[model samples]
Target: MWFHGPDKMINVHKMDRTCMALSFLSFDRKQDRRKQSAGAAGRKRFSVDFPFEAFTRDIWIICVSNVVGAFGEGLYFWVFPLYVMSLQADYIQLAIVTSALMGFAALVPIPGGLLADRLDRKKIIILSWTPWIFAPLIYSFAQDWTQLIPGTVCWGVSMLGLPAITAYVISSVGDEKKVTSVLSFVWASYSFSYIFAPAVGTYLATIIGMRSVLQISA
Candidate 1:
């Protein structure tokens, strides 16, 4: 092999270094593009995959309130007939009481829908929840089956808030496309409270008594 001139060797070395630098620069550019793409994908995933970002503050408040209300309701709803019977309600009386509850619950929602359309939904929700608190207290202090009527009526009236709550949830969603997801999420949160509260309520009733459990539920 012929030896290279020093100048030629130096030039060759410079060319090699330049090629290496160009290759490294190309690699860096590709890496930067990949990072940018990944970042954009991450941002898209955050916006699309996370549903809670669709809810407003009022939606969160409503969700929490519904959870607590559902929990309290679960504490008594399963054992309501037994409690009524304990107050000396006969079979016919029980039927009447349950029928009355159903009647009021079914009928009131008509006006409730009207009120929800006309009134402040938040105030309607608060008013409706107010009666539920008193209903449990009334049950705790009932002297007879007849005395339970007023409390059942109060409980029935609490349904007045349902439409308002539904409307509020729809309004609270920033994206209309997310309304179903938000409502389902909020409703599921409420129902989740029911899974354990009924069992706990029954245990508490056995330990302390049904009336005491009703008071605790209040």
Candidate 2:
């Protein structure tokens, strides 16, 4: 529902272009490897000439991507539970539904970490959105509590990218002193994305109904 603002839409487009540019601009870790070894024959394979250099271009790209996504999510998340209640779901059903999304917090980080180690961290962040693409679609079509499970599960799977995302951000900062503040700033972008989203969502939900908003989010 909140996605309609022309200003916000423009911001999303600009951010996307920025991410593309940043991706091309980022230094290759492999190239760094060659430079390190060429500079010092006896130096360790992973030694750094400049520790702050560990912070990579991908982190900037990620922060931009986060802003775009968090904007849409800020529109949908709180509205969803109220939508379920609108469906006349009972307390137990509500608990189960909420749990369906939360449950993945325990299970996904292992695979997320492995993926972080094995693949391009930027790509991991991008790929994480795939599961979320299905969530709004499922929510659009769901008529009952059981049908909501799939969307929530997809939402959970999207969260699997957190470990990879965190690692990238932390590595990019390359400063222990600044890590916590960096993380807080990154996460707080979600709050910043939608100052008016919940109010807009409530207004839209009242008029067009909740399912329509979910579809818009999708």
Candidate 3:
């Protein structure tokens, strides 16, 4: 007999993709470092200037946006499957929807990065949040999976702003040396929210139901 767990399979696939992306990113970083080292070896001046005001603003914005976005994402993860199940979707349908969303998300960042280089970063952030504000209300009214597809597509497209947001943070910090520290702080906050939001969302779902949780998340 054959045994398969759908959730486990999906998780394994995601892990594989993440590892591959990480490996490529690491290689790219190494190439960048080699080029930087060659440039530095040819230079004779080393000046350290700390722009405290600019650094403060950059850190504040990155921290605030990351925390808020992580909370929204965490709440969505907790409630979306429950919402779909409420609409009479089976496990296979749920998996299909999730896979589509993830597929679009992973593919969109490249275009997003290119567009971010050419466009106003702040506008991109606002535009990303625009669909999210409306998608949940649409989800609230959805009586079937067909009605859910539009909102799902909107949600998927909104993820294009993620790369833009990341680029903006890196640009704002200015000092490449501190970029990792700044990003780590922001990511730590985001990770912390994921640790707590699920339990709270689950309790809320039990008390007020999934639709209400979706509304709150939206």
**lDDT tens string, model 2, 46-95?**
34332334445666566676777666666678877777776779888888
> Where in model 2 is the C-alpha error above 4 Å?
1-57, 174-177
CA shift of 11, model 1, Å: 34
* Tens-place lDDT digits, model 1, residues 133-181: 9898998999899998898899899889989989989987879878888
Best by TM-score: 1
* Candidate 2 lDDT score at position 159: 84
Which portions of model 1 miss their true places by more than 4 Å?
Answer: 1-50
TM per candidate: 0.77, 0.67, 0.69
Q: Report, for all candidates in order, the number of backbone clashes.
A: 0, 1, 0
Predicted structure 1, TM vs. truth: 0.77
CA RMSD per model (angstroms): 5.3, 24.3, 23.7
Instruction: Quantify all predictions' global Cα lDDT against the true fold.
Output: 0.89, 0.76, 0.74
What lDDT is obtained when candidate 1 is compared to the true structure? Answer: 0.89
What is the alpha-carbon lDDT of model 2 when measured against the actual structure?
0.76
lDDT for 80 in candidate 3 is 81
Cα distance off (Å), candidate 1, residue 111: 0.7
| C-alpha lDDT of candidate 3 relative to the true structure | 0.74
